[model samples]
Target: MAKVHAEAQKEQILNAAARLFIEKGFGGASMQEIAEALGMTRTAVYYYFKNKDEILTALVEEVTLRARRLSSRATSEANTDPKEWLRTLVHQHTMLILSHHNEFRVVDRTEQQLPERAYRANEEAKRAVLSNFTAAIEAGVKVGVFRVVDAKVTAFTMIGMCSWPAFWYKPDGPKSAEEIADTIAELAVQSVIRPARRQLKSAGDVSEALALLREDLDHLSLMIEKQPKSG
Candidate 1:
């Protein structure tokens, strides 16, 4: 129960931080503003986060973690096809940004305020996301499913294309989140999948990989669910 409450409180701080950071850049949103948003004192907010930088750091790490957590499964599983894995990655990422657009904005726009340690941590999380793409690209190339190109560059390009959507996506715009996700998945697959290379592996091979990831996410979701409600 304590763990649950702690998680809820942390989320509360994150939510407040997201709103404040958006309304006011990193400099404009003070601890007092965040506490006031939550009807709490600055000290109380401090108890949860030492300072606004900490909150910003948390917000940035949150997005990176979510990105890594969602894709870890399909990428880690042995013998999974790269292109389909990229499809899953694109789909999950599009939904993630669109669903949590506010937090993602913090992820995309504001990070210079963080200390070197926090910045490195964010970079590490980003690297983890990049590594997954690199691995997927390598796997696809080896399996003859993707073009024999620069895996590192292609991976970076793929990830950049997928992760850059939080800047302009609209929930009520021309396309629903689902439609956008599908399009992203299709484009991602088409771009990377090698032309004339039709040696496709059955989904069953990737199922285990996907399940491995689902397990990780389920664990994460459960951990979040168990957190104490802090309203």
Candidate 2:
């Protein structure tokens, strides 16, 4: 369809702009340069985006929107399973960074240069992602699955870990994005998971537990018998 084709063209422009923004700082990159990069005329770029600021804002919004949507979907799908929720969130986040490293890096590097609207949208998206992560961690802690820790702090830490890949990930690296994501996801899950301890077996465990209960009851009875009688 024509609409689909137009949307795809818009995405190409955004991708070209992201690369230019990374190579040249947001303030350094110009509309002409972005147009040239895409092999289009300056007027063509302008038709899609009025100015460099508009392009930058579009880039920021696209990346943030992607992350926010991923977080929402992961949270909803794993609503009943906090451990799975956290794992899914971390994995998806990691993949997002690696798959779109240029866009991620551009936004990360141009925070101060972001337009007012873009900045607000970025901050709101961040808060939404953090809220999902914190809530999931809190849920796990409540159910005694995750260790006791500051859920907000843990969420922030994991987010930082995932975001760092945007700076250093290489497409030709030994590990693919999915492999790296899997490793990090597992690490995040294990970090909060409750430590394992020896479990009581069905036979001896039940007998030992009952014996301890009986001892406590007998001690309570003795203490009550020793109490002075009321008139």
Candidate 3:
């Protein structure tokens, strides 16, 4: 019980530090600030972490381990559909970003600030995650579900698309993280899937489609103009 409590305290400290690191860059956030945010004495904070870098290292290590585990699980499913694998990857990645927003933001923005050894370790874990995506894409291509393309490039693109939400996602926003994840997962699969050839539309049909698209664009513009801007 004591060990569990200690682990919980350490997690609390890391969460506080992650929030400060997100609000203020790594260089700008101090141990004093983290301690104050958690309502603990600086010495108490030191009990769990020797310094800011140590705290950052812990956060990175935790994220890396989790990513590796998720990647392993994603790839281990026997004969899973490639589209299902992609959906799982995107959903898990999005949920991770949403649940650990501050930690992920800190890692994304302050990666260069980590010690060289720690940075390299994190990169290895990241590569493992990327490899899982690449494997899934290649499998899809082999099964004729996806179009022929560079699997590595497509994996990177899908990762970038999924990771972008960590920067803009809000828990209280109009769309829940699950909804956003669903949309991204659909788009990611669509991006790689082989499209069925269809007969070309006549000029009149194309013109009508374009007019409908214009109306939708106009409606979207008006909606955006009505929304209040943040500072």
RMSD (Cα, Å) for all candidates, in order, is 16.5, 11.1, 10.9
Question: How would you encode candidate 2's per-residue C-alpha lDDT over 130-170 as one tens digit per residue?
Answer: 99889899998887778889999999999987888988998
Using Cα atoms with residue i matched to residue i, what is each candidate's TM-score against the true structure? 0.74, 0.81, 0.79
The whole-model lDDT of each prediction reads: 0.78, 0.86, 0.84
| Candidate 1, poorest ten consecutive residues by summed lDDT | 195-204
Candidate 1 lDDT over 84-118, as tens digits, reads 77777778877877777789778667666677887
Q: Which ten residues in a row have the lowest lDDT in candidate 3?
A: 195-204
- Top candidate on TM-score is 2
Candidate 2 whole-model C-alpha lDDT, 0 to 1: 0.86
**Candidate 2: misplaced stretches above 4 Å?**
196-231
